[model samples]
Target: MDLDAFVSAHYGEWEHLRALSSRRTLSGAGADELLDLYQRAATHLSLLRSAAPDPAVLQYLSTVLAKARTASLRRRTLSWSRVADFVVRDLPAVLYRTRWWWIGTALVNVVVAVLLGTWVARNPSVQTSFISPAAAQQLVNHDFSNYYSQYGGADFATHVWTNNVWVAALCIAFGVLGFPIAYVLWNNVVNVGVQGGIMVAYGHGSEFFGLILPHGILELTAVFVAAGSGLRLFWSWVEPGARTRADAMAHEGRSMVVVVLGLIGVLLVSGAIEAFVTPSGLPTFARVGIGVLAELAFLAYVFVLGRRAVREGFTGDVVAEDRSATRPTAA
Candidate 1:
């Protein structure tokens, strides 16, 4: 086979296929021409491989065939169906899957915060280290409570949402490294502890709980979820069990996308509560009740809807067709 002669004979059809594949829209006639070109290109590919076997020509023709095949096949488009499936299955399943990571994180951190708050309250030296006596008094007396209502509800909500989401985003983004997430958690709970301790020491414990619980319950829970998801990402590569480290990292990383998106919604709700309910004239019980309900609703979403999705073999991962190829397992 004369390679140059064969290429001269069939290059037009391959080029034509390439052109058609690159097109965004095609007419009926153009579509028919594309299919014809696709078939001819496939044949040309086979002939070149068997006879001429020129690497460059064979490679070009192979690429044309692949593009033509893909262009002719049905392309998946976004629709309500896909969005619904993602919300109902993908997001919740991911939340459910990483529940323990964040829950345990929350538990340990909360205990740490409580213990630290107690220590701070008892030790005048520790309290002064955080702030001078005058500043501490100011924070407990007026600054702490006034912070909630200073801005209008809408503005405050947006600010709080943006800030909380930023924190959550950092936790999710740095999940692989591990220690950065611990530092973020440390900064977060320490702030909570310092303020709570100051409020308690100043004889405003009830006021502290009243102002904080309304949004803190859900807001802090969302933060915990983000941190937990990050910790799990770290653990995925560390203790991949049967899977290789890269495979585990890839699988968990994809699922973290769902968790990241879901946390945005969670944080939004908590922000709203912080801005409106926390500062409203509503009774403390009513405000805190709302927060509790929101928290419970989220828990039910994970344990109920999330569990159902899991039972159906959902792993918070994209569909098998969409994700990377799974490694073959040995018996």
Candidate 2:
């Protein structure tokens, strides 16, 4: 248990180990020397623990050995494979699995918007409830179409993209609370319905559809998807099925975050359509047809690629190695 004598004997070896560890590159001899010193230091640490425990020497040996061990092990290099795997497999799989949740939300929102719009268009009192007759006329006559063409195409696209992304982000971020998502969906529904009704009432219904449908189909679908993901996330916490509540939330939350990233791209396309195509001189049929095609393409991506991915066991969460280790809890 002579700590000073032991330190004196091994100080040279310890110093060598530290030097080797600090080096950025190692020659064959240097690598061999590092391995030998690392092993000796480990043994020395064991002896220090058992026979002559000096805190300073033990601490120094531990740090040097830890560094040496790390250096000896090969490190993994980053690659694009992870990103490719996510886009090809994980993203689609999660979207497919959650298709019902969002599809239902889409249908319900559309129906509500349609009914409310029709009701408002049919009733003068309801039309006047929100908009004065003068304002309504102004909006119908000029503001409706002018809104799209007011800004340059690029600026309008960027503006719409940013705004829609913000809404989608909020849906995911606040989705843990169930009612917030419902409120968001309701607000969107009411806004669309009121606007549609006002436009139809003033006999600009054809023009309104011409402007909105091109971008609105995909844009609204993205919103619905986000709302669905958020609501399902809340439900995961409420009814975790076979998994623990924490597990369910972790799985669903990760998947939804990925959906948020994917939706950015989707919303970007929609914004482009709104900015460039909707306001362009394209015929109404052509414009609306383009939107429908884009919407169909997205649906196919989910139902085709997504279904296949789900079948292959992708779930849109982080790769297994990246997920945090968790203690198992009973469901």
Candidate 3:
């Protein structure tokens, strides 16, 4: 079809043009072809805009421009480095912006941990009491001390990393269900509480800290982030602000997708540490130091670095200043 006829036919179908442009194949030849077509369309649009062509022709030109813009964006997005940059830059911003949810989840975890600690501190026997007698006997008979000694080996590292990744992904995925967040929190609380009770019962509270705290700070923080994302999803359904529930959920899901992916990175790093480093029978003070440092780094990232990056995103440049200026003032 001739350019004028093509424009006339497609002028109002900007969305269709955009979809077609974004489907350009990912290859050197494909990219070159798409870029060439985009440039041609853009040039045509500029000429049409200047000429003040008929409304239909102008509409068609607008579709061409829209398609070109879409193609350009798709090309940029498909770059490996662009993917990495998005992960590093935008992911943190998403987490930072929704940090109140993260904080609430973290506080919930801390309360659970503290309550377990208190319970153990009160009833020393409950730790052993809560577990099955057979389990307690098996644990007492097994050389758990030696098992702990070998905990940070390669196999353990692989297992921890895999398990943590699975858990993190599940937490995010299950957020689609309204009750999954609650289920995750309940399970985590029980596991942590039971573990704490076990440590105190076995007179291994201090030893447990040395084993867990180094990586627990990062590991648990990752869980909290996941929980926060899930909570945000739940809140969208229950308390949509100025939007239909479906619309709010969709919007929140877009934001949480990035946050959930970022939390996966955190889980991977934390899992590696938990598997290979934390179980090395390190000194309590050293473990605590590492934990504290990790906590500080997370706080700085979420509250400072991440927030600053988001603020920098707003450049105060008016994208449609002419259109705004020409529009009539509202009554």
* Top candidate when judged by TM-score against the true structure: 1
RMSD (CA, Å), candidate 1 to true, equals 8.3
Task: Give the TM-score comparing model 1 with the true structure, all chains together.
Answer: 0.80
- Best first by TM-score, ranked: 1, 2, 3
lDDT of 1 at 330: 54
Q: Which one is best on lDDT?
A: 1
lDDT of each: 0.90, 0.89, 0.68
Question: What does candidate 2's lDDT look like per residue over 1-331, in tens digits?
Answer: 7788888899998888888887878999988988989899999999998997778877888998888887776344456997787778877888888889899999999999999999999999999998999999999998888999999999999999999999999888887988888888888999889989999988889999999999999999999898888888999999988778888899889889899999999999999999999999999999999999999999998999999998888888887876877667664
TM-score against native, each model: 0.80, 0.79, 0.67
Alpha carbon deviation, residue 168, candidate 1 (Å) = 0.7
Q: Given candidate 2, what's the lDDT at residue 330?
A: 63
What's the C-alpha lDDT at position 173 in model 2? Answer: 82
Residue 104, candidate 1: Cα error in Å is 0.7
| Higher-scoring candidate on TM-score, 1 or 3 | 1
Candidate 3: TM-score? 0.67
lDDT of 2: 0.89
Clashes of each: 0, 0, 1
